[model samples]
Target: MFATVAFAQANDDLTINTPPSIVQCKTTMISWDGGVSPFDLVRISISLSMHNTETPNLLLSINLRAKCSVTEEGVVVEDFPNILPGSSFDFFVDFPAGATLGFTVTDNNGDKAETAPVTVQESDESTCLSD
Candidate 1:
């Protein structure tokens, strides 16, 4: 059927704006929301290098542990899961509270398509700690 073909075509198309390139913390938050159909599986990955070399060293690897949730307060939440295209997800990491974070995204074909960096900030510190 023509309609079925069209649907498939549309669903195959996926697009998203990469997150920041440098984040500043151990717990970095990443989010993406674009695709023709709900993403079957979405993941946030990282490639670390010490001096920004052509090939950074492999420091660590991980996948989202649950589904991402968007809160009314504009905060994106994620437990980690296989995301569907045309949908969105969010997750946080456990980097230092003030360390820079970098990451990339890959599609179904194991292709690193996009990269984003963000600066991490301290969640909140008690005034007493300042002393």
Candidate 2:
């Protein structure tokens, strides 16, 4: 008897490399790798929940509004660019006080990868001063 092996190819192999940590009313740097389609648009979704707010179920697991386009000669063009393999993008997100945030990145091919859910802790620092 003989055995054979097969290797499968991935249409989209996007991966999120951001570590899982508690976000405490601060900006968190999110990064990823192994995505394709420079011409494809990148969509980022963040699930947020309020912890210190009086309002209930506010801003919970909502898709963040953002814009993406291609670049030409170091200038961003109003078109989708083809993202090469092994390329990466960085997203900076600010977590307001009393909010918990988790996020994921979707490639142009409709494939997505996410970081482990990170809970946002209430910070002692005030985002604004009360009058």
Candidate 3:
């Protein structure tokens, strides 16, 4: 029973999802969360797979953006350039407090694939004077 519980805990922490793609499919934006700083580091992850008959070449890429308000528009914060096939990358961007954060990933062919958005809020335990 102990072994089973441990296995379950591990499995719960794991993320299982299909890859993101341009020609074949849209990329999957994993998660976006704020950290403990005035300029918090927001992490973004993406997976890509190009397996369509039209584009046989497997290519992947990821990028991130941010906004002041969740209801307002967002601007590109960080560009990850390119991510090759069978590989994944994670990046962080400094987001101001109370700002809305957004992310988007594109394929090697320069196509907008996936997007993830999150609103930044003051952490309960944050010690910073400014939110």
Candidate 4:
């Protein structure tokens, strides 16, 4: 959903404490537990799961052109979804205006990343972009 929900426990029998690792632009929180790599649960599960934009998307849903800075490179996503590849601390799943959305972020070894679900809907106007 738009928020946390319980997932099945891992073979380790430890209920994954601390919800999924969500990386919202400035509000980033990434954690790993239950012997399950964050990438496995978040990236593999959600990324592969999404069908299309019209489909009710998983988390990291709203920002058409938002920037969540996990590093100097940060995560600069545009309406056109021009995602630059690089090794970063973590990654965020973004749904741009048109076309399909995908989580294409890799880690330091240039491998894929695991992330939490995030829903971003701002009622207020943005100062980041200008007309």
- Each prediction's number of clashing residue pairs: 36, 6, 3, 5
| lDDT (Cα atoms) of all candidates against the true structure | 0.39, 0.44, 0.32, 0.30
Deviation (Å) of 80 in candidate 2 = 13
- Residue 47 of candidate 2: its Cα lDDT? 36
State residue 23's C-alpha deviation in candidate 3, in Å: 32
**Who wins the TM-score comparison?**
2
Predict model 2's lDDT versus the native.
Answer: 0.44
Q: Which is the winner by lDDT between candidate 1 and candidate 4?
A: 1
Quick one: RMSD of model 1? 10.3
Give a tens-digit lDDT track for model 3, residues 1-131: 99997656433322212223211111233432221111222223222112222211221222344322211123343455534332244432232233333455443333333344343333433333223
Model 4: per-residue Cα lDDT over 1-131, one tens digit each: 42333334322231222333332232333333332333222222222122343333332322334543222111323232222331222344332222222233322233443333334323233343222
- What would the per-residue lDDT of candidate 1 be over residues 32-116, giving only the tens digit for each residue? 4333432333333233333334222233333345443322221222223345543445544444333334433445544333334
TM-score, ranked from best to worst = 2, 1, 3, 4
- The deviation in Å at residue 50 for candidate 3 is 40
Off by over 4 Å in 4: 1-14, 17-24, 36-39, 44-89, 93-118, 121-131
Give the C-alpha miss distance for residue 110 in model 3, angstroms: 2.9
TM-score between model 2 and native:
0.46
Candidate 2 residue runs with Cα over 4 Å from true position: 1-12, 39-93, 128-131
When 1 and 3 are scored with TM-score, the better candidate is: 1
Better of 2 and 4 by TM-score: 2
Pick out the ten consecutive residues of candidate 3 with the lowest summed lDDT.
32-41
Error of 3 at 83 (Å): 2.4
Please write out the lDDT profile of model 2 over residues 1-131, one tens digit for every residue: 12222112234477776545544534545566655444233322233333444433333222323443322221211222354543454333345543334445567667766666555555675453122
Residue 16 alpha-carbon offset, candidate 2, angstroms: 1.0
